[model samples]
Target: MKQDIPAVKQPVRSKILVVDDEPRIRDACRMVLSEQGFEVALAADGNEGVQMIQQEHFDVILVDLMMPVLSGFEVLSHVREAHPDTVVIVITGYATLEHSINAMKRGAFDFIPKPFTPDQLRAVVAKAIKYNRALQDIADTNSRLRTMVNRLTDGVMATDRDRRIVLANPAFLHLIGYHGESVLGRLIDEIHVSDQVREMIGQTLTMPSDEFTEPTEEIACSDDSGERIVRAKCAPFRGRDGSTIGTITVLNDITALKEFDRIRSDFVSMVCHEVRSPMNSMMMQIKVLLDGLAGELTDKQREILGRVSEKMSGLTTMVSELLDLSRLESGLIANEKSAVKMNEILREQVSFHAENGRRKNITIELRQPESLPPVLANQRNMEEVITNLVTNAIKYSPENTTVTVTATVENEYVRLSVQDQGYGIGADDLKRIFDRFYRVNDQNTRTIVGTGLGLAIVKSIVEAHHGSIKVSSTPGSGSTFTVLLPLVSI
Candidate 1:
């Protein structure tokens, strides 16, 4: 069985072009490179090399400096301008330091002296091949990323530390209504964007490199189409060394979501309004029956009616709280503002809740500086804020505990705190305590009666008055709720 087997062909590693006036040198390069599995082509002079390059693509180009028609320097310049990806190496008898420097400056990858061995040529070519591949990989990755960003629906933009726009996608240009030819290297302030977005970016850029907090805001933008709501989020952009070098802003159009929220709030308000009148009438009728105006009632009948009345009262309170939340969301409550003495409001709330605290043997104490500054706020709303906090404190605390209310001036703002010795909230429940209808479920809080809307309404009112609220709690210890409101300019 002596059957002859055909030889298998190996794929060429690279395509190389050798251009020289000397026929012996040109032939020698072709033989050496061909033996190393490279597809090699020869040229008599620089003119022939350039013509072959124009006709086809080559991975590496080897040229001699002392060419007859066109010099290697000319070929290097042409390759740099036309096919920059192609690696060019210079081979010459005049391999002096000056000639090597000149060749390098002209964009030659590396220099090889005349009478070079095959190993020397292979080593230099291998290094050039590795570098060239790395550059190609980077270019490919950048191209893919740009394509992905351009096709996204959300807008993405990046700026340098100097506030100059470095990268902006097509979606960002459309969102900002920019029809300019280019936006690169332009200052963010010069661009026709919303002031809120510019401020967010500016703040993020100026933040310390160690701290990373993304600032987000809903901005109104108007263009030829119409006015729309855009939610812009800005964060610090960090470099390889983990230092912030710039800022990035991502924008999403939320016009539809906002419209949906408005519609939902309107529906809820209408339903609450219609049910409120009928519910009030029912409550009055129940009160009259309890008073024996309809007829004389037995103890069992009275107790049953009392339970009904209590449930009705809870429902009425829930309805009212929902209505208040609607009004706050609609900005109706924020319209009424005046110079209000927070200390006076605190005194009135403490006195009002005194009896409720006494029933549980809990003391409601107020500590305030004598001459506290007045805050620009709605008096009735501020009173509600105090009422809710004091009521919660008294309701949640054990018998004979004290709920201390304090007011102090803190740097152009009035700091109000309501500290309660109660079954403190756990770390998990503290996060959503201000959310509507969210109640902490546990044994200590099970018997307590509440609509779970007090803290939510308080938070809405506080934010509407340009104030802030925060809470700190430790399990089984106590909780402190603090409010900070800016003082009115005297």
Candidate 2:
């Protein structure tokens, strides 16, 4: 009779080592395991088994207790001490309670009698292989986790419910002037480094978990290299059950960011001062020459002087805006409130910007006031705000575009708006228009002569008065800027 058989898919073969003194038992065991898809190696005695284990890796080891050269107990001890992850099974005819207990106490996986069946032997080996794979997985996961925590730049530390440090990364050890051995198995508050650091940790631990956020403060430290700044934040540490066990703190160094801001602000102030002194002198001398105080000039010479004066005027406007920006950034500008009428300020600003309007033939229109509210604000700052807005509208609008200024009183406050017909700002540039030195880098805005300080100053001056300003615009259309101020002291 002929029979058909189906093929069974098998997992990768597990490795096994068998050490027995009897040749017949070894050959029988090898034949049975080889058919079961196991890679088996043979060792004659306990001594030979130990030598093979020392040189190769195996998932399971089977040893006979009664052997020459070395006993099974001695080999079991060596395997447990050297390769604890390898599963070991002891085989012996002397299978008494004392022998089984002794093998188990020496870390044996299981014990088998001398007259064991093929099924019983395969069952024991399969159980040992399964247990070994679990241990291998756990060890591999721990190795990967350790590598991540060890190489983190920001210091990471965790404590237990008893408030004792359970884990500290390498960065944490380096941050607080302590070695890894010193920080482990120690108390967090017991750290004797910076008092500020200790206090920060103490405060964070006592606070509710919801209250902990990012870095609370930056600490200044002077070292051999120079001054350094470090920021620290602490929050609740969780256990496997998602319950707060302790606090975890992270420290980041940010000395360079703070230094860069300081350097940039100082450079702006210095350049403005250095350039303003000489430019002011040149303007005064040129004014005298144009006024004919030096000599009467011909028509051609007069035209040339006028052109020079117009270019000088543009420079003067830029220098003034730069000075205003420097003052705003340095916190030198103050808002000392005085009673001011919106209608009066708007009329004065429109008159002052009349020449700018004539240059582009743009009409500056102001709605005639009926009843208007007065706000308490610094007169100079209030005037500067209106002037900057009007000047920008004039500079950006095309020929004969009408710029309208409107004033109204709304619920104990006054709303002043300046609307213009010009090429509007793009969405990306609109958000950053008031940032210092941020000019739009597009075709419509690049040709305009500005130091990018006009809108920044306008924003600062309006904010200083405790007023709010907002804008809405569309591309190819125009923009409307509205400023709100308290009708009475806010």
- TM-score of model 2 vs. true structure: 0.45
Measured on C-alpha atoms, candidate 2 has an lDDT of 0.79
Global lDDT of each model? 0.86, 0.79
In the range 15-108, model 1's lDDT, one tens digit per residue, is: 8899889999889888888887888999899898888888888888999998876999998888888789898899989989999999999899
How far out, in Å, is residue 177 in model 1? 1.2
Best by lDDT: 1
Q: What residue runs in model 1 are displaced by over 4 Å at the alpha carbon? A: 1-13, 185-191, 269-490
lDDT of 1: 0.86
Q: Which consecutive 10 residues in model 1 have the weakest lDDT in total?
A: 330-339
> Residue by residue across 89-147, what tens digits does model 2's lDDT show?
99999999999999999999898899899999999888888899898889999889778
Q: Provide TM-scores for the models.
A: 0.56, 0.45
Flag clash pairs in model 1. Answer: none
Q: Model 2: residues >4 Å from true position, as ranges?
A: 1-13, 22-25, 65-73, 92-106, 109-115, 158-169, 177-217, 244-248, 261-490
